[model samples]
Target: MNTTPGTRWDVIVVGAGAGGMSTAIFAARNGARVLVIDAAPEEGGALHLATGQLSAAGTRLQRSKGIEDTPESHLADIVRISKDTADRELVWLAVSNAAATIDWLLDDLAMPVLPEHPVRGQNHEHYSQDRYYWGPDLGRSILAAVRAPFRELIDSGAVTARFGTEVVGLVQDPEAQGGRVTGVVTADGEEHHGTNVVLATGGYNADPALFEKMNGVPAYADASYRFARGAGHRLGVDAGGYTRNHDLYLCSFGSVLEHDDFPAPVLCRPVHWPEMRMPWEIYVNVEGRRFVAEDEPSVDVREHALLRQTDLRRYIVFDGRMLREAPPMIPGWSADDVRAHAGRHPMFHVADDLRTLAASAGIDPDNLVATVEEYNANRDGEDPLGRRFRPLPLAEAPFYAIRVQGMSITSTAGLAVDAGLRVVRPDGTAVPGLYALGELLGSGAFMGNSFCGGMLATPAMTFGRLLGTGILSW
Candidate 1:
């Protein structure tokens, strides 16, 4: 393939985060002159706001620990966890090539996991095998790990990066094969031509309007990477690529948002994992009804139950006694500290009685009183929701309610792509010279309606490695 005249880059990668950096690094190493561009002042994309959990089977660390695993088993878990809703072909592609990607991170990149890693993480549905891993520093560790190699490439001039630069449009030829994407035009009105253009822009979680438009739910938490505002999604759609998996949107039980706003920053995450801590409090929806069993063991069950609620929100309701007698509901904040915030914070509401408490927290007052009455009456016996951990009742006075909103940091809808990861048309034909990786591919493609451990980050880098190694050609 002959290089285009006046085209300064072999591959122009937009969004210099995990997938983009990995692509640029390996593409440059493979002898392609790479150009990296990002809207943010620096790279690291979602990793800055991510937990950076990585899942892989048959990695060097697993082998060292005598833990035998395979992509087949990993895929089996994903299918089981996602209820067979995930895209099989794309998932297989990522899983089959995942081990080498993890090995590269742990061995070649010198990134180390926690001492007792490879555990079935508790946040999401646990994978059957112990294959999930992350470093102590979480997302930042991955940032540090990938940045070293990317920095080396940057210093060597094999890769050229422009920070604070946004790719406004992709230069395409309608006459070419399937709207061939030849280059990208930056916001500054400068065209940077390349043989290939990769859209690795993260997700739409930070954009409330786009989040509601895409997922059919208002973005409740502004916890995603700030730069993830659907630039990649719009770009891909404009380039003749379609987005899919819109129906696979799923949210966690929730987090304590800082304000009553539609989209607010997360103040603190609740330790709602029953495995980590059993519930002494009850969760009531806006209808003031106990929807799911508070002591539900399956995280998936809890998440789905919350999904059916009115606003993907739940109020953690408890009595003053539950606060004093039970384990601390919210970590770092004790009973006294919790009392300090009651009636002061918008999220934390307190009342002398159940009706007042409900009204204060925007709950149905009469329904809340009835719900609490029913809950207290069935404290020692069988619960309607089949909740097993009913150690105490919501009878104590000065009732409290802390509002928690269910939200997702990753966008569920993403650009449609073929197994080779080329952004594809609705007819499943690849758009020439256009490829998409990472969250731009949507978490739904990997985990479907469920959040599988490490599926997002692992596959992002793995697909990047695959494309850089051999998939992409000039």
Candidate 2:
């Protein structure tokens, strides 16, 4: 579909990712003329890099497998994992419609999820039931599923997609009309008028300035899509929409960075799963105190524990004997790589003594020595942090420490939206014609301070489908 310069559209969606595509497809299927504008050179914004993990309860796949599940169960799991900080109404909406979203992909779009999927997820906190899902090609598989129908809609002249176009600002009605959104203005100064505008511009994880502004902490790693610079966030703010959820910022535990640079690109992530590799290294904070059990089973506990530390940074401490004898601490790295990178890499350090090792890693020397001594002394008894698997002592010479920091793959803060997906002001008044879906509304909206599996992408796709199907009145 081609767009004429001044033609009015029924819906204008910014960002051509999972949520934006879903919104355009559903809206067009409902007989609306939809125009989608994205800043990327091509569509599939973050999906190209996303893991595409999703979760839903009581879907046809679950039923066929005889797996007992329900939306109520899904809602309960998310609230429990999020510690009740998640917006209840938004969680309810996402979970309620999640099954339908998954079914649409599987049954309608004929997308193939792994046959043995719907399992408890491994990366984040595990759901009680087997509700997690992913495709063989990760996020690209999900994009293929959405893009097929979306292209069909485009060919039918119901949806028009313009890539390499950025929505710089939203057009709003007069102050007399409560400043309702009217359309959007592109970076090229072209104004596109529409009855409804959906901001699916994703998150600001890629922008260090906005990441620190919204999250109250500096971004530690550059792991998100580069185009996710929070354009929709700015557009929503310009249209009188407020943002929230800064207090709910959460970070993943460990990522090996390419260098010592702040917001450094990730080289590889370390595998800290106890089941995969038994405890050989202990994690210590800047104060040189053990913050969490080295072999803690729950990833959520480890991540939350890291949040309380200074700057959300920690060091993995191990001695030469353990480094040589224990299973590889960093995933995909040979034991030789660990030894080689220790003294050479900016993120890794090694010294002949405990105090020297502590000094090299910016840890308090006295406290680090005491912490290591305490662990060595308690080898036969229950560990102070209740660490059950104390396989080796850190008494060997030539100690090593690998600096690690908390990092997030998604932005936690975003434009505030009501239950109907309408962007709202700080005073709680809706900005008519402006709706937000997906990461533009923030992962904190549904996932809270915890990393809830499938909450981000699932809700983005679900709300996009709902909004396109006329769930909100224009």
Candidate 3:
């Protein structure tokens, strides 16, 4: 749909991802005329690549399995995982409405969720209850569910979606009106007026420069949606919204990249979870010292440990014996493929001894040898770093090292918003007619300093639904 210049909309949503679509659909259903603008050729921003993982308590799916859960329990789990760093009121809002949002998708939109879902998630830290869920097709499935009803609204003229339209600036009222947002100006130099504006343009992980600037660390891999360039952040700031949670930046472990260069695209993420597959090698930092337990049960601990390493990088040190006997370190990689990549891949190094392997992998040679020797000597006793699983020793010839870097899939800092999802200034006053949700609020707002299962996507949808369904005055 084409957005005519000077057209007045009840709500102007600056993105077409999960958050914006939810806002548009619900607002249209509520008899509000909505306009959704996106810079991409299509809608469904990060949802195209998102895992679509979501968690909620008191859902019918959980009840069907006789799993007793509550919003309180969900809040508790997130607070515990985030170490009380998450915004309590905002988290309460998300958790309390999460089940309703899921039900809206399942019963109203006919979204397909896995039959045996609400399982305890395996990727991030595990929640105490089985409230995690995802569709077989991942984010696409969730997007499809939202898209169907959204398209119906568009067809009926309740909503107008303009793809390839980028919102360049937010139109703010004069100082007498507290500088409230009036509408938005697009990159095409068209002004569209609206009663309220919602920013859902996702995160900044795809923009290496912005990612490094915001998080104060280099983005090792480019693995997020390409359009996530922090447009919402910049626009919100221009309209006097204060950003927060910059210090909450954290990275996840186990991403194998296509190259050793900065901002390299991820080739694949190896399954390093001990429960899924016991580790057959030791993980060492640049100084060749063991950091976390190779078989650490908690993914959160392992990820944080990796963050403390030099340059947030580590080397998975193993030997020829491990290559032959243990499970393949790279999931789905064949033995021949592993052998081929050992010397051929830029991230992989193979040498006849620990010293040579360290040299090739840029690790301290003496420290690498000493670390391996200590592990070999302690095979009969408790291992350092509290490692419980030591399946093999690096005693065999042809020691190998695979370089891995800690990386993030989302931006941690973002525009600050209140419990009502209204963008706020540095003094904690609300910016009238302005709202923010999704990754525009930053992964740190909900997930805090850690990765809470299903925190990001679910809250984005919940806040969008709330804003669209009369949470904001027209």
Put down candidate 1 lDDT per residue, 1-474, tens digits, no spaces.
Answer: 213356568788999888998898889999988889999999899998788899999888899999999999999999999999999998999898899998999899888789998897759999888899998889988999999999999998888889999988999999987688988888887888887888999898888999999999999888889999999999999998899999999999899999978789988887898988999999999999999999899999999999999999899999988888998777787899889989999999999998889888999999999999899898888899999988888887889999999989899999998887888888888899999999999999999999999999999898888778766443
Q: In candidate 2, where is summed lDDT lowest over 10 consecutive residues?
A: 1-10
Once fitted onto the true fold, the runs of candidate 3 whose alpha carbons sit more than 4 angstroms away are 1-6, 472-474
Candidate 3 to native Cα RMSD, angstroms: 1.5
Better of 1 and 3 by lDDT: 1
TM-score, candidate 3, is 0.98
| Total clashing pairs for each candidate | 0, 0, 0
Off by more than 4 A, model 1: 1-5, 472-474
Give the distance in Å from residue 90's predicted Cα in candidate 1 to where it truly belongs.
1.0
lDDT of 2 by residue, 1-474 (tens): 124666888999999899999999999989998999999988888999999999999899999999999999999998899999888899999999999999999899888889888898878999999999989999999999999998888788888888999888888776746887888888888888888899999999889999999999998888899899999899889888889999999888878788867789988777788877777888899999999998899889999999889989889899889888887777778878888888898889999998999888899999999999999999899888999998888988789998887889899988999988999999998998899999988988898999999888999999999999987665
Error of 3 at 260 (Å): 2.9
Candidate 1 residue pairs that clash: none
